[model samples]
Target chain A: MESSSNRLFSARDLIGFAVLIAIIFVVLPIALDGFRLNLFGKYLTYAFVAVGLVLCWGMGGILSLGQGVFFGLGGYCMAMFLKLEASTPENTSIQSTPGIPDFMDWNQLTALPAWWEPFNSLFITLIAVILVPVVFAFIIGVAMFRRRVGGVYFAIITQAFAAILTILIIGQQGFTGGVNGITDLRTLKGWDIRSEEAKEILYFVNGGLLIVCLVIAQYVRKSKLGRLLIAMRDQEDRVRFSGYDVASFKIFIFCLGAAFAAVGGAMFTLQVGFMSPTLVGIVPSIEMVIFCAVGGRLSILGAVYGALLVNWAKTSLSESFPELWLLGLGGLFIAVVMVFPNGLAGVYAEHVEPRLMALLGKSKAAAPDSAANETPAE
Target chain B: MFSDYTMNELGAIFAMQGFAGLILFSVFVLMALGLAIIFGQMGVINMAHGEFMILGAYVTYLTSNLFADYLPSVFGLYFFVAMILAFIASGALGLFVEWVMIRHLYKRPLDTLLATWGLSLILQQVYRSVFGAREVGVSIPDWMMGSLPMTDMIEVPINGIFVMVLATGISLAVYFMMYRSSWGLQVRAISQNRMMADAVGINTAWTDRLTFGIGCGVAGVAGSAFTMIGSTGPTAGQLYIVDTFLVVVFGGAASLLGTIASAFSISQAQSIMEFFLSGSMAKVLTLLTVVGILMIRPQGLFTLKLRK
Candidate 1:
């Protein structure tokens, strides 16, 4: 019951965090050249989402399949800003409507649309990046959680949300850049973002923000509200009977998860320089869940590893043999759910950690005790 | 929006769109009925539902080819044979999946969703590999190719009528099987109280398998009928999965009447709105409405009374 309020970082947790930091911040920068490091940085952006999933789905047991919606919303918000800046009158001097985006010009729009007006301001766009998804998450969370509609039903509804958003984006091609997405992103507030230096800077910024998100997630996990979330997840009625506002907790964590995902989305657009409906759709949303599942949904650090490893595998496999990626991903989904419900983190905690402890001349009992202590509060 | 069209033109437009909506409704009903049975009865989120439908579409495509090449004289009669074969093929696959995957995750509904999603991905890949990535079209037999001239401006396609008839017949068959048979009682009994049904000598596992199979079989039939109105592709089923699930969910999961009512309303709304707005805006509005209503009424339009 008091597990949430335990030491914020056990020695094991500190070591894991340190190792994760070393990989993301130090080793990768040294080993990989510019392009690959930028790719890893993109993967780290997704890690922010995985960390949020670790809290929302792993601990709170509220599986939102539409995390991509939040991510996309965040990315688009930033992309809108970058796109507007890139589509300045001087930048598009030859177009019929010099101030408007090229896609809008192609679609025969004479002026910048009303919605695109606010995005011209960088401050507003930055605020909108986080606020848009958080608000959307709040509405969804409050509506569903308050009604106590959850489990597979919630999962399906969220998935439907992703589908709806994708369709809307694709259908509104004139405004959204359609299936091609918001491309030709060139600069951010006069800084030429297409430079290799900018890519490296964005990569570091993405990594730095991910680490910040990790700390925030760790704080939430060690807080009393985290305990309440676990308590509600495992036994909702019990928490309700105990006079706690179960819905409020669920809504908070869900919104928090959305905020984290939104940040990741913004970072994704920053590093990748594009935002599209493809990333904001049903397939990518579900794939995001797989990242959390593979990493060890229960472990925040594991989530970072999960995002890195899965994305790494996806890039390498798809690059070589695109046909095998889907098969491998499908097989991995089944294997993770059935064979390793605890995921990579679970495997490590159960098998590898104990062996490591023994080799360190420490008591093996401690490893099993920690594992048992983290049994989702059920 | 109505200012551009006079009364007669508006009437004609509404009538044409309404008929189109009815055809869409038939497709929705066909798709939703199977989902309602599987999701409501078995508590398994079969994300591969669309794939099952696509399997039927592929089966129909194969049967059409076979008739075209091997039995030209009976090409007109190939559709009926195709429908039956599609049902069998999809049902068999559903049964296999139930045994291998679904049964293991019955205790974890969320896990079932993920596992079945994985299953959907694998099935989609298989279809893509076997049938190629291109969408396939069945040759409309000579008899089903023309249109019925209801008026100068309101012509109806024979294929649409055929699909409507097929949908009605299958829906009636499903109604009979669910309400007027002993098997359906066992299914309902299991859905209501699995432990009690098991204690009362019901073959719960077998019933579950059969229910899943039947659901997939129905989806196969839906897919077969679908080829008349649209092209079939490896991922065709995915395009409609969300809409079908919405239909089932909006109708109240366990209620057949609710499913039909919801499907009718959604399809009609979509078709009618599509005529007035852009196709994407219409879809967005219709889905947004359904989702909004669902948020407010999560049990859906109708819910069965049961003790928790």
Candidate 2:
């Protein structure tokens, strides 16, 4: 009983969770103003995708370079809903088409397309945000995994999907708001999202949802399924011979990751007040993978911090020294892969966690299955 | 779409579109050859491949300027010199990248992808800094400027023809090098069984470097050809990277013939579709079909019948 309880949440794990929670819910809100907090909220949305990557890439050894597709889909779904609400006939009376989106009107679309009709309902839009990406991922996962296509092949294929989606979005401008994406999302069910108070509420809501996701991730990590994922990553043939349906597990995790990214996308639309093809393309998609890598793919908590740190750096560095930002980012990619393959989580496990244990007078034997000792050098 | 044109005009359009496709096919083949050599032979995905090609383009641009300024009498022949220089410059860089970054990550193919992508980013920034972030075009010599009047309605650009000829020559050369040369024999052996090749007295490490350098050299040559058709920019290479990758993957890895065939088919499909559909739609459709087909036949259009 004690072992099982410890497996679910070791003392160290609990401490890590508490610290992360405090940082997100307590410290960040106190330290920054509403505007900066909103910006951090935007960054935290990326953490959702990063956390999903931890499960898919880190644990399952499935590196999807197209998480942005799911993110974009989710954002678009939410954006479509908001755009529909904002495009009430009275609001869009100046346009030739008074009931449809302005972009659609510009493109000379007389009416809302049948597909866009469902997004009118918030409940339907919310559900579609998750379902669309999961369905897309399910199709991709099934197609690739069943054929036993994986590793670099899977990564490239996912990237192609990102490219395809981007082109489709940009090409079908009338329907998808073109390359500009669904923008000028003013409200959410008539609650002015652009206002300070609403942004603050959305941030806390985003933070709460993120905490729920982290706990769910932790539960999965401590489960037998998580052990199976690690084993499958290391030795696929052995796992297959052991009577497990490897493809199904891969499909499940990929879908879950897609779903997480979708939620992040929805939150992003709410916070950033727009969705654009820039967020759905190859560059952003690959950047999302780097976030997972930087966070230490093995740790969900690390993914959040990784997302925050990398994004913060990107925002500040680009704002100050645009020329140096790409160089720094490029260097970070090399350093993360070459020097610190385990990322912040690995570093913490190796350097910080052990020292913390020592400072607290705890025996090292108490945490035999710590992530650091088990991380096979890839 | 066909209803708009008479039969004679339709035939002319088809002929014109076919020629356009052939030019695109040349570009695809050139880019895919280098990528195929690297990915197929070494099992390394160099995302920086497009950047290498752009490096070749920048070299060509510089060479054109040099010839026009200093060697006015030999301006027409500067292209030949530029191609060779591009090969050397890009090849040398590939060799260095392999030594510094790729060598350590040989055991990790995915990590190689990330590292090379970083290399690509750095290379892009370097190009932006050096070239002022603007698209640079090379001046075409007088001999390469005219179009051949193939028909009343159809004319062939001399540069397009030149690029095609160059692509064909490079393809044949690569085919011979891969199939007939002793270095090619060592590369195939190493790719097939590294341990056996090493035990049989081959310098596997040096061979790997040479293979990578040659692959990148081929990309540089492709880039040299590219400057004839398009402008060179820091980010232009990225646009081609995905298409080039799809071409290589669609053609099975490890098969030069497959790469050529796949590139030809994809380029033709895309070019022909571009006439009837919007360019972006054509691209999306072409990519979708390729990806859909890839899903069904994961081994690609061709596969090596190797005994594992």
Candidate 3:
């Protein structure tokens, strides 16, 4: 059990599997049109959220219903930066632009307010994606976790935070872009987003980021910190007996998840070139949790798979029969929850084992779950 | 017309805003009470709670439509009947969900949030399919419409008085049901310790269903009543969910009195500020204040701890 050299997957095998994933994602842009690419871009942003849920929820057992708060925080930060960059240097009276965020016109606000001056720099905006959510999360997490808030209690608190944030953003029409939110950005760093090269670059970036996150997560899943996290999730009191600072671990994982969510937000803003309060709210936040649950929260790739699949279904369902979309979504969750308590990945682990990673061959000598009962801290 | 009131008019302004605030507080209390019952006693987060309220609103709408067709002269009385019907309809659904879905997942509260959230979306779409997308305005009966005669400067709306009275009466009835009744005793016992109650031969399953139904039934009544102040639409429930959640949570999970107090404070702050500031600004101020207060008292306004 303690052999250092014997590992689940060798470095070469991981690289090969990564290559196959790269090929599929890298080829997708060429295979699909602009509209489809845009839709996938939205999915990628959602996957950003899934990545975080994998840690905070799957591993830490923190059923945070409002990852959207972090997602929105990041999105708003990027949106603010994008808006600044898009603004003319001369402060020309930006004419009655029809789709130019409704808040700007509703408040009859003239020339960007003084508070918005700093977001003008793209670099700062980028930095804010990480900083704002981290700070907010740390403050919130520390206060709550220190009190040993876990389970549904923790979830409801986070939801309330998201709700308050949403209401504040919606009500503060001028500053936060209100209900309509920020929109109508022309470019990012002078690169035409419409160009094929730019689209491919975005795709590669999203895909690469996803894999890098996967690797980091893998290491964390196996490390002592990971075991400690799982231990914390199962029984906090016991972990305390084992001499671990449960509060710090909770905060660390929570912050790591938030940071990943922000990165997703940044990439999403770059793709959509806009952000709205609706992007991060109670509704979307709950949806992210559902995605993780449905995909099997304990598995990293399962979360990614769930995010992609659920988003695809949402898009297609809403577009196909707008009337039945909600019903279909609800029914799907019911079926998933009722049928697969461990989620879709659990099904694969049970039945379609050899088929999933077929590239590695049917009877691979070693596989993860090297210890069958041992669950990864996803 | 919208500027701050003159010194002479300030008393009248405060009186009006205060009355409006009271009504608003009543609505919050009603909404939060139902949620508190479900969450506190049952340990379940019913995300579709707003949908149950919508069902109540629809019932009221249907009752209005029925009265208009059958006996237009007796239309005002339809509200009472409609509220009962909505209570039954939504409660029946709550019972069904508790028995079928929620019962199995009793130990997993977070999962219930997602499952119910999905349920809410489904119910909303169903309402949209049936009610149509446009906001449906319920006709306030002649007696209920317009304002009550008061001093020249202070004219309180008839509906505001109606809501306040109804909220107080219903909340009292609910309190009686929860605190003073045998059924409520069983519910309290179950909430306190499920295994102990089960050992004591309480009909735990039935209690769970009935408690959930009552919570939803209260939500139904709230929805029916909300048709007076707010618009009736498929998505109307979404409007109150945030505010209701805030009130319930700020009041703490275990205390009903806290719910009432929290509602009173939040609503009063909102309405008073709205008189001077814009609607949005008032909301921002209220939220900032609540967040600050919650940061201090994470257990909420009235933290009633028994088990711990």
Error of 1 at A166 (Å): 1.4
Residue-level lDDT of model 1, residues B115-148, one tens digit each, is 8888888888898899998999999799999999
Best by DockQ: 2
Model 3, A160-244: lDDT tens per residue? 7787788788877777778878877666877766566676677678877877777777667767777777787777789999888
lDDT of 3 by residue, B220-273 (tens): 998999888777889878777777777887888778888899999999999999
lDDT of 2 by residue, A1-378 (tens): 347543778776788899988998899999999989999999999999999999999898898999999999999999999999999999999999898999999999998899989999999998999999999999999999999999999999999999999999999999998889999889888799999999999999999999988888888788777888888888988999999999999999999999999999999999989999999999999999999889998889999999999999999999999999999989989999999998998888778877887898977643455632256434
In candidate 1, which residue ranges exceed 4 Å CA deviation?
Answer: A1-5, A366-369, A372-378
Write down the TM-score of model 1's second chain: 0.99
Model 2: residues >4 Å from true position, as ranges?
A: A1-6, A363-367, A371-373, A376-378
Q: Write the per-residue lDDT of candidate 1 for residues A294-325, one digit (tens) a residue.
A: 98988888898899999999999999999888
Which CAPRI level is candidate 3?
acceptable
All DockQ scores: 0.65, 0.78, 0.43
Q: What proportion of true contacts does candidate 2 retain?
A: 0.71
Clash pairs, candidate 1, are: none
TM-scores of all predicted structures:
0.98, 0.98, 0.92
